[model samples]
Target: MPERTETSPAHHGHQRSPGREQLETATTVFALLADPTRLHLLWLLAGGEADVTELASESEAARPAVSQHLAKLRLAGLVQARKDGRRMVYSLRDGHLRRLVTEALSHADHQVTGAPWHA
Candidate 1:
């Protein structure tokens, strides 16, 4: 066992490039996520794959709205869908994206509810 730190100094050596391309791309993804409904959908998908009906029921949004959000998320490369027989099951496309959404919502919860933040 060893002492733990929030971040290791060696990790900073792998920082992403400062090129505008990454910034612009991230901005586009954030723009797509601006809607609450879409963000909720992403949160659900981050947990695991689910069909539109489950998402709608859990999120309390209309089925059509959930479908539309899933479509947009799929198009934005944030999520993926596959036909499980007649049903289309959806999930996050990248593992990094799952953590990104989870971390963001956790941070928001802390801010909205005045909970203590943890790294």
Candidate 2:
């Protein structure tokens, strides 16, 4: 078996530790996620891609507010947008982000519901 190192994931796995640049980038991603509206937008996108109108309607955040939040997320590279006819559809840029948003919400659910944490 491979010996665990400081860089390993969960302190006992094989994943490498994030370097300084990666840490800064992750910090920026976390900062963007700090906003409730932005997080909601991301959570919605985790389900699948959607255009602005659909997102605004589902989130009930207003068309303009959703657009602004999407702009920030797009600029941060957490999400991507593409023109679908006349509408701009958005989606999580990668599976990693989708999983991250899903896991974050799952963690929040545990805290709010007083559920036991899983290993």
Candidate 3:
């Protein structure tokens, strides 16, 4: 894999163009949430942690399908898993992720409804 580099221009003591970082981060997070299965998985985890079987049942998706989405979320660092006896329970890694998702959704809703979240 190519070595990841910080592409954004730097400032005095902080990264410049935070909007750029927000957009990039939002894009990645949105991409992860794009799939219905993954979204459902997130919703489930929003309530609490669950294993593959639990998530599959809650999402009404096949085990492999749920596992696939979980893998992607894990790879994205959006979700973390812990072995609970024989099952691996997954949960959202960052509390900010929930806010990010909520804010993005609110923005979209506002755009469609012509009631912007920001003035």
lDDT of 1 by residue, 1-99 (tens): 344355743253435444798779889888987899998998988889999999999999999999988888888888889999999999899877787
Error of 2 at 35 (Å): 0.6
Q: Which residue pairs clash in candidate 2? A: none
Off by over 4 Å in 1: 1-14
Per-model TM against the reference: 0.85, 0.88, 0.69
Query: Candidate 2 residues 28-105, lDDT tens each?
Result: 998998998889999999999999899999888899999999999998899999998899999999887887788899
Say which prediction, candidate 1 or candidate 3, comes out ahead on TM-score: 1
Model 2 vs. true fold: TM: 0.88
Worst 10 contiguous positions by lDDT, candidate 1: 9-18
What is the C-alpha local distance difference test score of each model?
A: 0.85, 0.88, 0.81
Model 3 C-alpha lDDT per residue in residues 1-119, reported as the tens digit of each score = 34435642342234444688778986898888888788878878877889999999989999999999999999999999999888899998876776566655667789899984663
Against the true structure, what is every candidate's RMSD? 4.9, 3.4, 7.8
- Overlapping backbone residue pairs in candidate 3 total 0
C-alpha-based local distance difference test score of model 2: 0.88
The numbered model that scores best in lDDT is 2
